[model samples]
Target: MTQAQNPFNVVFVLFDNVTQLNFTGPAQFLCRMPGAKVHVAAASLDPVMTDVGFGIMPTVTFEDCPQSDLLCVPGGLGVAPALSDIQLIDFVGQQASDAQWITSVCTGAFILGQAGLLQGRRATTHWGFTSLLPMVGAVHEDARTVFDGNIVTAGGVTSGIDFALTIVAHLHGEDVARSLQLNFEYDPAPPFAGGTPATSPQHIVQAMQSRFYDDRAAEMEKALRG
Candidate 1:
């Protein structure tokens, strides 16, 4: 795509249980990426409620989502149904068939994997699910973010901002990304003791898995069966 002629069309696919921060983070960060244009695309026309209770009105449907230059799947509990929905999976699977750069935040990687796009690709997801990546045929990489081929996957939720910065660096230039990072004062401040499994105590991790991630885990397993 030519620079002047091509509008860098970006679509972030959202669904129920999607992490609001994943979309909001990158949307805010990359809103400044030169010619980058963004839209919220979803499986349905209805306003999809996120896991955190935020409602995102999708601007386009999968069938209607414009030919995207950059396509992102932002992770959440939505990844559960998205992986299982053949239509949604087929829609995203087509993205890999085409040449558009595909990216996912957190467990969105699981959706992409269900579409059979991540087979043998080096990808990363919410570090909590790192061990789970191999089951879907991804080469698990332990990183805050990982870039392999056309796929760029970010760790957990907040990392989506950094992932967008990286894309800005790749799409525009490193200077632009760095500038935005500085503009945002992109530094870490964690209110909690654990951001990742390694940082969280074993008991805490187990508690999280049992209490928080249990339903989502079951949903994923059901999707994998299909």
Candidate 2:
């Protein structure tokens, strides 16, 4: 027989253009928690097109999202588009006001930053957004995961799995987290050995980065203005 260390209700907020891998990785870990429940929330109840063009049917809308013990925000290309929605930004900000833990993956930290939730909180996000995050009052931790008291932020998309395991440990104790980890048998072998800008070949990294933001650069300028 085992004991439940803590009981939790989790709310996962998804938006259009969100990266599916970013959401799915953490979700897989969260759903495995014993006696835990999750609510999938969106700006609207309608299906959202992910950054990769996959669609997800949201189970709840911001208007109807259940109050949660934990609020999770996921990041992707959608962030640039979603931040334009003041209500959604406000929703995440307010939700974190009462949540026991404010968690984010990848560029999801951008949402928390816009909501002003990450101010003074040590956090991390996708490598590309690291510099901008600190400008918003974050500590700019460069790690696969950063746990600053109640705020937990993970770097990049694949980092979601590591962050979730950390969360499970915090809530249910290391024993439970270890058990879950053993159950999942995670043995990842990423083909790309590079993670951060400093470690990767500068030429390849710069080229890849240029391709990503080539279009967004103008949009980013506009976003800053309006």
TM-score of each: 0.90, 0.90
Model 1: lDDT of residue 148: 93
Give per-residue lDDT, candidate 1, residue 135.
73
Model 2, which residues run further than 4 Å from truth?
Answer: 1-7, 214-225
- Full-model lDDT for every candidate: 0.83, 0.84
Tens digits of per-residue lDDT, candidate 1, 1-226, equal 6556566788888778788998899889877888777878777789989887868899889888877788888888777667767877787877656646899899999988888888999999986677778778999988988999889999999999989998898888899899999998988777887788888899988998888787667667677776
Candidate 2 per-residue lDDT, tens place, 1-226, comes to 8986765778888988899988988888998887678888987878989988879998888888878788989998888777778888888987888999899999888788788888898999887767677656788877889999888999999899999998988878999988888888887766987677787899988897788855554454355346
